[model samples]
Target: MEVLLAVDVRNELRRIGWISLQPNGSVSVGLNDRTFVSPDFKAKNFVWNAYNRVTIQYLISSDPKALKPIKNPHLTFHPPIKFQLRANGQHMLFEGIADLNIMLQQDGRVPWIRFVSKPVSELSKAGPSWNPDRTKILSIRLGNEDCSIGLGVDFVRKDVDVPTEDLLLSEFIDWQDYKLYVHSVAIPAQIATLSWYHQK
Candidate 1:
């Protein structure tokens, strides 16, 4: 399946070149870690004209890393990007300003990124609580299942003020600072899961 991702840059966060997405049952968005993220990879999102502004083709079964150009300069944060994904002649719209984020780490930077909501300080003192309004609505599976990774989209709607998504998280729980399942992604069980167990 070839999926097309289109977003409203005016109403949301600025979109960059390498910031691409492959629509599978996972996180379908990609951030341009170094090249696009910077001039300075951490502070500003300085992308160039070489970036693919609006044309994206995502095969549900392709390797996220296998896709050229989209696999480098990984960013540290993935906020819920509002977009309309079309696949199989179906259009899916995701609307919300995101406060939930997943930091994408270098393949070997630290094995995981921070999954945070409120400040770590607040959650520690008050204990952790799950909110429906805050149920992450991005279908970002941490491990792969013979599928592609990268920033792909697979969301489920849990009832609440906002919809809850399946983060497919495990291993550690810090509440406000939920330990990461993965900073990078792939769809196949071989690619992501193997890396998760072997490298981690």
Candidate 2:
């Protein structure tokens, strides 16, 4: 299953001050409660433009080893999934689980599960560019999944001029010896912009 989630930037800005692009082309980003300053325009622009406008996508699946049929299961037991966005402190952007519904097939021997979420808007408010030297952290808790939780970080770099090398980071996590999951990938500007435009 695929889960799409968004960060509420308006609320996040309220909790943490807004990022700003200085007149001198410098960037000021508020993480936690402290401000970080940087001289990289591309990095700042990438984060500033993408911040709240970007939506996160997660690919979810059942643990292969734990997929045995159950004799009896609770039909209404939907699990809660929580996520946190933090720069320096906590930016409570989103917290909730996908709406899940289960139905029995006509054969009465099979079941189907459907997950849904309300549409999210793709609007960008005013903000400064992002600083490539700083990093932003996002953590997710998949409450009932075998892999209970995971962490993702947005790191910016300007040392490399090639666009392909701009977003270069990947990580994996192992859960209970049951799954080896790709935890995170650095977001590229092209992908981020596409994601923002895709949101309605």
Candidate 3:
């Protein structure tokens, strides 16, 4: 399993010359070059209907989608392939979201969605007390009863549509260890273990 990174982003479309204050004191807004259209009514012949006299100002806006969209190369996600993590013993189910990344593999032009095997990099405000880790570390150590993990995963489904793709999220369970940056945490001479295996 591979750990992938996902970041949320938004693109701003509103710009200068797109909005202006008319001499009549009305706020005129529109897509600089696009014609305005809207779902509203109302017309009264001010010249003929003296009873309907009233003042009105207009502030036009467009639907979010109607505004031109910007492409984001960083976003390669599409309909998520399904995945489930089940731990050994008592059949406890581990749940997670696998922010799927749709990619074209070298094996063929066919698209594939990669599963996240670890918690996504931080931006989390849930605080340290919130344990959303979905990795095998915890699942593989339930009260010292001896453990292993079973994972079920599937590839991109044929009928999946791009308009409303199902997204997934993966969690962090445990790590044999994590690397330290800025400085070395250990050296070969200070090692205690001789071989690598899942942490006990």
Candidate 4:
């Protein structure tokens, strides 16, 4: 049986912009643009008069057909793909909005969704935590029963999207072993098309 990352990301699309938080994570989505079309109250007065107005936002996911293994020409490291997620709030909000809410009303479910995997270079190392640039190590463990696996993220597109990856050990190990495991398969990008409330 394959164990996949299971968690729901709830987003609050408010007047100013969209706000969301993962089940138990601090990383949240914020605006990366301001091209969103504002509601035209004069032309369609009833639309804005309604309570709990539904403003649509675009969600981008990887094209299942786009899934391809990360072929490295240098072959320095071939880490297993780790499941990860990311987003640029500004880009998604504008694109989804300009699409006339088509992407947000997907089968009455999520609008646009994609799935893609990440490269293995993101896996955590087993040796001492020392950065050439002297960046302090955040967490030394994967926050699981065994500390072999570690969770790391990839900033595929700084403002447009984010990819989340997870590291996993191939073999089970005791905590004392302190060995690193092979990263799990990376989860393709998923569009999080969401409806929000516009603050006017």
Candidate 1 backbone clash number: 25
Q: Please write out the lDDT profile of model 2 over residues 57-126, one tens digit for every residue.
A: 4222222233321111111111211122223332322222221111111111111111111111221222
Superposed Cα deviation of residue 171, candidate 2 (Å) = 5.0
Give the C-alpha miss distance for residue 31 in model 3, angstroms.
2.8
TM-score of each: 0.18, 0.19, 0.14, 0.19
Cα shift from native, residue 19, model 2 (Å):
24
- In model 1, the runs with Cα more than 4 Å from the true position are 1-68, 71-73, 78-97, 101-170, 173-177, 182-200
Q: lDDT of all predictions, in order shown?
A: 0.23, 0.21, 0.19, 0.22
Give the range where candidate 2 is weakest over 10 consecutive residues by summed lDDT.
191-200
RMSD of each: 19.1, 22.7, 27.2, 18.5
lDDT of 4 by residue, 1-200 (tens): 11122111122111111122223322222221112122221111123322344543222322333332111100001111111122332112221112212322321222121112222222222233233253222222222221112222211211222222443312221111121121222233322112222211
Which sequence of candidate numbers ranks them by TM-score, best first? 4, 2, 1, 3
lDDT of 3 at 2: 16
The Cα error of candidate 3 at residue 77, in Å, is 45
Model 3, TM vs. native: 0.14
Report the C-alpha lDDT of model 3 over 161-191, residue by residue, as the tens digit: 2222222222321211111010001111210
Q: Which ten residues in a row have the lowest lDDT in candidate 3?
A: 191-200
By lDDT, the better pick of 2 and 4 is 4
